[model samples]
Target: MTTSTTRQPIHTSPINLTFLGTASAQPSSTRNHSALTLRLGSDAWLFDCGEATQHQIQKSAVKMGRIEKIFITHTHGDHIFGLLPLMAACLNGAGGTVDGADDPRTQVNLNDSPMEIYGPLGTRAYIRNGLIYTHTLLGRPYVVHELRFPGDPQDGDFTHLPPHRSESPNGRNIPLKTDLNDTGTWRNIYSDNVLSVSAAPILHSVPCVGYVVNEASVPGKIDPTKYIPDIKRTKTPMSVMRRLQEGEDVELSDGTVLSGPPRRPGRKIVVLGDTYDPSPVASLAQGADLLVHEATNAHLPGIDPATKETDTYESVQERAISRGHSTPQMAGKFATLIDAKKLILNHFSARYPGDDDVNEEARKIMEGIRDMASFEYDGPVLCARDLMSEDVVLQQDNR
Candidate 1:
């Protein structure tokens, strides 16, 4: 008797998302302003191209030709000021926009495609205005799809207010409520067949958004040749194996059935371009495999590590809310609230020099928060730095 064991082949494509820049409002010696490259397949999703992002890219393995989508969270100078130079240089290398895409490629070469810019309304006009003043240098076409929210930015979250607010006569400076402005309101940004993007407003002075990118499930591969009948069974040709790998389940006249293993999603990454509280982004970021939160105010090393578990540790939550960015403690709390598997806090303020300060701060747990008053969800936390690349993929267990 012949025995054949089928191993459900799990093929995983490693996705390496490199942090090109991770500063919030300003760039310091330890950190640069906002910029990130989401390596989804061969394409790259650029979030908030701040000043010097192109320079950062040049220093990394990110091929300048691979950047496809540039999603600007807001028009803030720190978030999008560097767009002009990045766009111009990319276009110039690809040729001119209106007349540039015609570049012919040799057998081994491929021409760079138009870069898609995704942002708020008037983005096209803003880029054009910048380009108009600058000399003609690039010729690559890019389309900006504005992501306009349903409501205003500065208004408090109307969805989270108690229902009794309406009953109160002439409420005391309480803001109006709306489900659209809820803490967990997530809006689907983009989707094709396999992958989709969703985003929600993060706590920021401007109309900023934190995005969640998700890829669809992929079925596992099966070995049809293993299902061959035992009566004088013959080895199937390589062509047959290829077809089976393509999900062509088949039954032979000899009564053999071939099947594949269970299917599952690739992975989930909760990447925040630049945010503070990010309470509004909870819905979109719920159950994220990884949370890349902004840790603009982690100054932990100044304090002793023993104080992390002690009652004397001061919480940075208030400072985070006031500054419109998150502290390490707040970032950890946000990650825990969203059921994230891992928390990576970066985007430090220029004030803190060297990542030792960042590591010290993020590691310093908030001793100030009393358990009775709130839920301080603390999980695994790590700080992010520019030029650092991390691997993330959705596994079946994550699903």
Candidate 2:
């Protein structure tokens, strides 16, 4: 007689990040472009989708149907161009019922809901024009909502747009009108039971902002023995159990009182998208479990042979003003100043093939900063790879 075995599905704790397109510009055969996916339990959020971002998603661990939220940093082609393909994939690629599937969570309506998008400005028009032309709305209505920080919307479309420069006084919405109406104000972009997102104004030729997504504070796990029930031994009721777990007073059936919840481990993660060289961004990501910054070029100050003109060089600071880009050094220092737990340099320039130069130069800068920062802030520093996944945990099992 032979016995057969069934493979049980593994449960993975901690959220993960899948790098869809790490390149800063257009998608080449070797590199896709700038796109990232944040996995929060069953929900995945997209941060900037450039050309071929959907392709990258297809090649990675992310399921097109799982991503319900997309947050675009700015409306650059390298950032928002992939919205169509990603949307199509979600419409046609996922949430279909399988014959023998038995996962209990798949029976819910959220399992089939379309994506929810959030961005700076012009996002609604951009998506509507692109999707409407292609007839991309298939089974569900994928909603794209705009995020208006404290200051923005100089055009005075506050309901749909951000605030305005006229609102601040010596201020108002933003400062000038270039990128996001040149408003120098920031806001929290995304949030839920597990995580929260915040935005920061960065220097750029166009309106650009960096995002910071943080893991939310987690409540302590409760001890099952504490909720022990007698008589029928059916255990504690969910409402009373919830209140007790929250460390609040709860009344039992017999008028007995319960208090306190045992504590458990917790962690936080942050991602910094494309922006010019700025210090406040680092502070925004301070004490983060992870920091993903854009490294568009290998910055060394006048070491170029590509183009002899001023338009040829693209540093993190100058690019934000001239061509709107960021260099490796700027990214490294920003992560260092904020004292991030982990620094992940991303958004590579298409100038170098295979992204070899960016890795070498960016590593050197981070190493130098670690030596000079005058704190024992030695932690993991990674150079993100296209279509790769990063598991960001609040605490490691061994730790």
Q: Which portions of model 2 miss their true places by more than 4 Å?
A: 1-12, 92-114, 149-189, 220-266, 280-283, 299-321, 355-377, 396-399
RMSD of 1: 12.2
lDDT for position 127 in model 2: 65
lDDT tens per residue, model 2, 200-302: 6565655566777755445465675766653124354565666666667666666666665643434555655566655545555566677777766553333
Q: Mind sharing the TM-score for model 1?
A: 0.72
Q: Choose the strongest candidate by TM-score.
A: 1
Local lDDT at 135 for model 1? 34
**Sliding window of 10 residues with minimal summed lDDT for model 2:** 163-172
Per model, state how many residue pairs clash: 8, 18
